[model samples]
Target: MELALGELLDERLITLDLQATEREGAIRELAGLIDRAGKLADRDEYVNAVLAREALGSTGVGHGVAIPHGKSPAVREAAVAFGRSRTGVDFAAPDGRPADLVFLIAAPEGAHDLHLKALAHLARRLVHDEVREALRQAGSAHEVVRVLAQA
Candidate 1:
């Protein structure tokens, strides 16, 4: 099945002010957001999986964006959580700059290939300056969703 970004994103999963100043802390915060949304069956396990992925390579794709993701059995469903930090977080981005936008993606273990494809699509859309600017200027979670929907 093709995964739709709109179906995976929820306004409640968007956080305008992230409190984390570091990578791990940022991942934890985003994981907590999805967990609170009832998307993770085991929050710790899911977060650990994402951390493990980070160990392999930082997901900080630069341009002030970090896409941290993992496929694990702990995920109850495939979902994405969006967060923005006004102060920026040290996500070990390839460009060596702090990341202001974070997108944490959780996928069930069985959906490995699908996850990759979906992530690719999201990455392509995120590369557009217009989309990035819109997300940055979004005033509320609803506004964030609207911006993403337009992408």
Candidate 2:
């Protein structure tokens, strides 16, 4: 993947303790981070895009992970918001497991498929047990960044 996940991920985008109870809520919670970081041009539009994508198919990739993304004109740039929950949220995973690690990606419509690249890269990285364990045990946002950077 040409796009470095580290470029889209940062301490400001990481949430180690998520309070969301379900999929939609978790998405909204993470998308709010993108909005606050000034990457989202229009919160409602971007959120709608993500929800629409979810309607087409669940983004839950199994293994306690979910990657929800939106490629929309409402995004100013590519950004990722990550949340970790102690109590998992239902994401309709085929494995029938709730997701504790959630990633919300916002990509500008003109970002040249960066979102797909990020998704693929994260999928590849998270497939490793060490990476997932590091994420789960990360104590701070900086730790999360360090994990992704190294992974």
Candidate 3:
């Protein structure tokens, strides 16, 4: 079956109130979400992969959004964790705007790039101003999932 954003982004993985102040903290917080959902076999290993990717280049793709992803054996399944920061976290975005909307994609090491596909799908949705606005204003985890499901 094809990967679907609405399915991969389980509502249990969405957080409307992110408490991180920086990039790594934000990523760890999101990873914790995925781990709690039992999608990660080894949270540290998965987090290391993502931070390593960040070292190569910031995942912050501008427009107040950041998509951080990793492929590792630690991933039990392909999952997407969503977090929204009211105060915004500094993700070193190219546009220099703090990222308020963050997506953490976890894909298994030999899953043939599922994370990349999810990242691409989300990127397409985020380019629309209305979608971003809807996420920023989402009142609950279900609302956030609804926006992404429709977007």
What is the lDDT of every predicted structure here? 0.90, 0.91, 0.92
Query: How many backbone clashes does every candidate have?
Result: 0, 0, 0
lDDT of 1 by residue, 1-151 (tens): 6557888899979999999998889999999999999999999999999999999988989899999999999999888999999899877888988899999999999985866876886888899999999999999999998888778
Best prediction by lDDT: 3
Candidates ranked by TM-score: 2, 3, 1
lDDT computed for candidate 3 = 0.92
Q: Which of the predicted structures, 1 or 3, would earn the higher TM-score when compared with the native?
A: 3
Query: Model 3 over residues 1-151: C-alpha lDDT tens digits?
Result: 5557987888899999999989999999999999999999999999999999999999998899999999999999889999999899888899999999999999999999788789889998999999999999989999988998888
Give the root-mean-square deviation of each candidate in angstroms: 1.1, 0.9, 1.0
Stretches of model 2 off by over 4 angstroms after superposition: none
- Candidate 1, overall lDDT? 0.90
- Collision pairs in model 3: none
